[model samples]
Target: MNPTEFLDGGTVTVSDETYTVYKTEHPESAAFATIQDENETTVVAEAGTVSGENVIESEPGWKRLTFEMVLPFELVGFLAAVATALADEDISIFAISAYSTDHVLVKEEDVPVATKKLEALGCAVER
Candidate 1:
């Protein structure tokens, strides 16, 4: 199947809350998404929620664009297509994949352009 075909009839919704990506020594229970590995704990949460000593690094002002569709486990290249679309426009993204769908976090300043890029790829964007 074509990579962009997955976008057909799908919607990309922009979240109102700005988020921050934090690399912390310990897991944050309140984080929107947290990944723990032998190296470190990466936490994504609303800006200012996770901070202080445990946090080794923090990058704030990210806006989440949620692909509001259930992507089948067998689907291929969906995220690659989306990332490529945004990259073509020089927008960087932090991606997260859930059991049902995927989300990409772009710098807050790039939301407008990113929205347009996603829309151009056949996904309706909800700002």
Candidate 2:
């Protein structure tokens, strides 16, 4: 795929809800995203949604920005370009790739800069 074609004409939507990343011992059904391995469970859900003894740590106030395009499996460097753009601005991101598209979680305070960086890459960002 052409890099320009992959970068341009894509929509990135900022979610209205704030999320939290949690490291928990148990699964959370309400989590927006979850990953479990032999040692731990990582959960990303709405802020203040998950609690109790199972949760080992939590990082709150993250906002999700979703790439609204259905990416082809063979497409490459899409995320690398985005990550590099943001990294240049010193913005950290937690990325999640679903079957159809990709999402990135940025600290609430970094949304504006992150949006601008993504926009610079030719993505139409909706906040």
Candidate 3:
């Protein structure tokens, strides 16, 4: 997994069962332009969500990126490692996942350090 960190997302949550999200034309979300309104939900970041409905709100000044690698059921440690790496650097990350891979978001400036930290933990990432 040649890890490439693309930090550029914002944190957001939904109050309803359905909402729309806008993507920045990133190659990652090329498969789906919008995640249809569904019952399942979790913390979402605005960085990937170009636009959305259901009264979406979030913390300002944050960034997001998809992990450089693909881990199926190994997300537990993947997340732990990410958290550990960021915790040590005093950085915060908000993460989400799709059926194929996971997405993590940190501050815009913290991208460099977060990238290095995750790389040290055996996760492939790019600067």
Candidate 4:
């Protein structure tokens, strides 16, 4: 697919809730979503989950921005554009892609900067 076609998924929305990333052992709770890798389990859970001695490390104060369109399975460069835009401005991002959509996480303090850069790329941002 053409690179420009990637941005067709429009209107990225920033989630109001704050998210914390935790490095921990396997979390058995199904109440929250968790992703695991061999090195550590990355947990995106309620603030309460950050507690407990099981957490080996943690990064708090993250905000999520989700692209609101159903991206085509074959599309490419969607994330690159967004990430590059933020990176150019020295904003860091943690990105995730599911079957139909993409999500990006940035430091809570950088939400405004991230949102503005995305808008400059012609993406309507809702924060």
Over 1-127, each residue of candidate 2 has an lDDT whose tens digit, in order, gives: 8655866878999999999999999989999999899999999999988976778999999999999989899888878888888999999999999997899999999999999888888889997
Which residue pairs clash in candidate 2? none
**Given candidate 1, what's the lDDT at residue 2?**
66
**Once superposed on the true structure, which residue ranges of model 2 sit more than 4 Å away at CA?**
none
Worst 10 residues of 2 by lDDT: 1-10
**What lDDT tens digits, residue by residue, belong to model 3 across residues 27-76?**
22322223443442233433334334432443445555565444656335
Compared with the true structure, the alpha-carbon lDDT of candidate 2 equals 0.91
List pairs with backbone clashes in candidate 1. Answer: none
Residue runs of model 3 more than 4 Å from their true location after superposition: 1-56, 74-76, 122-124
- Count the clashes in each prediction: 0, 0, 17, 0
Tens digits of per-residue lDDT for model 1, 20-113: 9999999888799998988988999999887588889999999999999888888899999999989999999999999999999999999999
Q: List the residue pairs that clash in candidate 4.
A: none
Candidate 3 lDDT at 92 equals: 80
**Runs with alpha carbons beyond 4 Å of true place in candidate 4:** 6-9, 28-32
Steric clash count of candidate 3: 17
| TM-score of each model, in listed order | 0.96, 0.95, 0.53, 0.87
Q: How far is candidate 4 from the true structure (C-alpha RMSD, Å)?
A: 2.0
Q: Relative to the true structure, how large is the alpha-carbon lDDT of every model?
A: 0.91, 0.91, 0.49, 0.78
Better TM-score candidate (1, 3)? 1
Sort every candidate by TM-score, greatest first: 1, 2, 4, 3
RMSD of each: 0.9, 1.0, 10.1, 2.0
